[model samples]
Target chain A: MTKTHYFYIGYGLLCLLGITSPLLNPWEGATTVWDRLYLKFYGVSPYGGFSLLSFLFYSIIYTGFLYQFQLFLTDYLSGRFYYTAIRYQSLARWFIHLGWQMSYKAACFLVVLATVTVLIGLALGDSPELTVSVLSNLTVIQLLIQFLLNGWLQLMNGLMIVFITAWVFKEPSYNLIAMGLLTIAALPVLNAGGWLPAGLNSTAYLSGQWEDLILITMKLVVYLLIQLVVIAVLFKRKNIAFY
Target chain B: MKLIEVVNVSKSFKGIQIFNQANAVFEQGNIYGILGPNGSGKSVLFKLICGFIKPDQGDIIIHPSYRSRRADFPQNFGIIIDRPGYAAGLTGFENLKRWAEIRNQIKDEDIKRTMRVVGLDPDARQKMKSYSLGMKQKIAFAQAIMENQQVLILDEPFNAMDVDSVKVLRELLIKYKQEGRTIILTSHNEEDIELLCDQVYQIRSHKLVPVNTMAKV
Candidate 1:
């Protein structure tokens, strides 16, 4: 297989693992109740939505994203009107690519985690969680490892995405590069503070970290935006049509 | 219909002019070979026709629609410029899968069948990085034929092929022409020029001047 093919396969496997991890943690009767319900003690449910149905639902959505990603890659590589083969590549952009798939899922993950945090908070008590969830109260602490590792995965992914886009489209603007850095940097900060919840943040933790996290998030988002605008300007100058 | 036409074409590199007012014509269903001395811009002419490189002064037009550029087209066309581009790190199967649907010319099953025709492994379980130069050439050929395009551009088909491989390709090109496909191939092998092409375009004096018959050993 080609490196890109392996990259697709390997990345799919990693993303599959990332997606399935939640399912394992939250599946009922699969783990001890101690493992199942504890956000502090266990972590983010072994899955999502409190059931296999939930996991299945998210899996379907993820598969759609994955499918679109594959299509985008196909079209990006060989499809050209000049060449005339496939449709436009949606996952063509770095921000849209990273932020679109995992980041969006990460966003939904935060919302789900938030919603679960509140419901569980009402059902269980404050500080009720799992051990894996509790490995670090600070996601930034995990950023060096877990979150950082996630960021690192995304960084490599983003880098690869940008590299390929530039290679195929033959246009890699400074904005794209700058935006990529900003996304990686800012995304981790949000993850650190709490935009897209991972690790284990109970309701109590979410509330307290809200303000500082928001600030960090704004800084990152604005930097990301500026980079995007710069990219937009570059695209405009070069007459790049994203269509 | 005029299959290919170049008008008022000019080329330059780093303030050096190599081609000026170069023009040529290619008719449909003809197997044309390009021949030239080194630095005669033979490959450059092929690229300009294949839409890889643009001439600074003039434009090339492919007839029936009179558009020469691939970027301006609405339908399918295929090309292999200079050297083939492939992801050497992927499996042959996986790599083909990446390009199997080029221009929507071939379906997935057709691609698989083509891969099989070229003796590529069904599963393409081997990475292209590990492929020998011979294997890589075969894969490149498979990719080109995978999509049944009307116009096929091959810069140098005999780059690393064995004699048998070359023979196979000659037969394959003849078969494709029988099916009425336009193939524009360039090679240093005079035999390739003689055996395959119906006509030959020689890059002499920085221009494509048609040789009456491209058949001579």
Candidate 2:
């Protein structure tokens, strides 16, 4: 197996032991799988002043995913990339292929996180039915689907932001801008709306109304499409010099 | 026939000129050598030839064959402008096999023969991370010639290679030239340039100056 496969296994173990273990323990207060998920996402909020430990735990996953992605992206910056890229008919096609790979990685990470959450929740005897205060209109299955879709979108947004930032600055090291953005977005503040870049990932910001959810989802999708165009433009002029 | 031409090409980085109205010609069935001091943009010229980077001014006219293939970069050209990289966890053979799978022009026996040509054990299971620098360079060389590319742009292709391996590669390059392949390389070793190059050029004052005609240009 590749190092990436091992990394996923390690990430799963870390989540099981560090994040979900304490949150889903039977000794914790009245909680269903929905409640556990709610608390988990609640810690992602900038305003609530929720569990600091929980927030840090989830942040590790986010940070780790970004770190892995950064490494993957930089691999193409090496000299060998030119040799491989020339084999392709067009550099744009190669860039698009890389985008698809990045999207696949984002989806895979969400699946890993979801699998770990479900395993922990089931083992601890938490009911799968929805019990969260927010998004009360949706059934358990719908809520879960929304959660996965939202999580995947947020990860894609983050990845694109990092990629665009690096390309704009013409420095691979500029990926730290994403880390800084995450730090500022995580700062405690009142009324942290879903409009905040990082807060969009928080379930606490999700409204009960399906209209709001759809609007937010559409907005994110549009924003991601625009970002894709911007990245392609930047890449068109980017010089692949890595001395 | 002229295979590649750099016509009045000018390039600069961060406002510092690397090349200014430079001109050079590479024809088929010849080994050309470029010599330059550190920071002289030897690699940049190779990158320009391979279409990895654009020249700021003037044109790099590749032969019609590349354009005929509809490839933005030069097709069927083997390049090693910088240190080659591969999956560090995979064996040398496996790494070459993975790269070969991209074009599917070469099979397992071809890969093994290339490895043997470069003085590597094709059956060895040693991962790339464990290979010495010389071994790694051989792997890079093996990959470059494995597909029988007609054009080769190599920068410091013999770096880190031992004497015997270097001699073997030098002979292989001559053999490639005999087979009507065009090869361009940069080397610090005077012997490599003396024994191999059909024509030699040196990077001087942001231009490629023909070594034998240095008094004129």
By DockQ, the best candidate is 2
TM-score of each: 0.55, 0.89
True contacts kept of 1: 0.00
Q: Distance (Å) between predicted and true CA of A186, model 1? A: 12
Worst 10 residues of 1 chain B by lDDT: B66-75
| Candidate 2: clashing pairs of residues | none
- Candidate 1: RMSD to truth: 11.0
| Residue lDDT tens for model 1, A124-206 | 43333333242234342322222223322333333334434544355335335533343333232334544432222221122
- What does chain B score (TM) in every candidate? 0.88, 0.96
lDDT of 1 at A127: 35
